[model samples]
Target: MDNFSFYDLQPKISNFPDEVLAGLSKQQKQIPPKFFYDEYGSKIFDQICELEEYYPTRTEFGILQQHSSDIADQIGENSLIIEYGSGSSQKICFLLDSLIKPWAYMPIDISREHMLSASKTIADKYPNLKVLGVYADYTTEMLLPEYAISSVQKKVIFFPGTTIGNLEPEEAIQLLKRSAMIVGSCGGMLIGFDMKKDPQILHASYNDSKGVTAAFNINLLTRINRELEASFDTNTFTHYAFFNPQKSRIEMHLISLVEQTVVISDRLFNFLEGESIHTENSYKFSVQEIENMSERTGFKLIRFWTDPKKHFYPG
Candidate 1:
């Protein structure tokens, strides 16, 4: 048995630099998107996955169930399976089970607990499968561990869950380019993208009536308070999300319910009543856009499948 070391992806800001802190304080209310993955936030997200309105997880999993054999056939043998944001390794099991043979399984994630838990489960179920879990964020520039994969084998990057939507166009392209460099010339990439659809359908998916998404969004502040020793009134903030047609994204925000001042260590920040801080934007993509992105980024579009009901684009 191999002993796995735990890692955290948090940026080490020893001194919350005055200028940067001041800039953040200038906003009536402000919170960065990175704070959204505390243990509580991750648990809430798992709840959101079970929600009826949240369709991406279920729809994408369904597509995999139906076409896993075909997808596995295309991937072929002796390729290392690498997944981005591989949490719990739940959805991935479908594909791996269907594959005839694979050299290794590398799941990259930001959470050390998830990486360890998921990797252990996979290792237990598939005795012969080599499992390597990387505790790092693949979105940013970082050197991947050399031992994670064999230099001689073909690489296949599995970036499912419409995660590309989290990035802007340029960032998405850069990620794809990185994938190209990692996989080399002979390999392929499989990914998922939520397709453009009716405004109502798209809007309802994120801003569900049960408000689980809202809880998850606001939970980011709670994480910041706990991790950074900051004082934030979680009850004084509310979550807001809307479809921005101009940007073609679902923008999420945390609006202050009342004016207040929060202190973090030595700095004091003030917020105006009803003001908002932008948290994240999830950009959806058209099929053509996805294909073009792949082409421009040096990956030929292998094959993509969508549910017959038109909910998502799974490849």
Candidate 2:
């Protein structure tokens, strides 16, 4: 029988209003990209991955399919796979299929309901595998279940999907260092990096023809409306995504179509016409940059695999 345990570190009611107000108050208004996963946002993202223009998910999966055996060999046996921002827990299935007696799977994420649902589904499929769901923002320091820490032969951090690109370089370095600590000396990390690519290709990935990406971006505001009792005319906000070559990032923003004021729990935030709230930034990296980052964070990259077209890398 598979045993599943869920830990709720995120509040039942999100602190999103506080985050929203703080971001809105900034000189250059911006919200953290992590805020995009409130149930609805998460579902929209799953759809975005299936879009023809969105290649990262598919590209990464191909690399995993071709290299899972090799990756499993490198990972060795009796390992505990801890995934940050586990999302649908789909990609890890490939790794789990290849790993030799992986003792447990710990999926840490901020979306409690989604994480629990995925964890249960994964448990059902991997009947002998232990699934522990930690409901907390993985960006912050987290406490792993005592059993996960004490019983595992090896602790491998499986951070796929190139999610690390969402963080600034400095923040990414810190997170890598933290993961190194959690995995301890004997363990290794298998991560994915979205390689730098043509600006046109990058632009199309975030601005799909079906406008699923736009809906995904706008859903953040809808989340605020539902959770914070905010009056946000979501229709009045347009989704905008563009590649900033200078910064080597894809920036997504919600542009206010008209001057408006939104109220959340007695607090008022005013937006002028054309004003935008920066929602997310996906940074692209070079192979050299990934090597340098791993070196700086004390991880020795044993191997890296990428598609023939070099669209994405899973190492």
Q: Which candidate number maximizes lDDT?
A: 2
The local distance difference test score of each candidate is: 0.80, 0.88
The reply for model 1, stretches above 4 Å from the true place, is 2-23, 26-30, 147-151
Root-mean-square deviation of Cα positions for candidate 2 versus the true structure, in angstroms:
2.2
Model 1 gets an lDDT of 0.80
Name the lDDT value of residue 184 in candidate 2: 86
Error of 1 at 26 (Å): 5.8
Given candidate 2, what's the lDDT at residue 309? 92
Please give the distance, in angstroms, between residue 203's alpha carbon in candidate 2 and its true position after superposition.
0.5
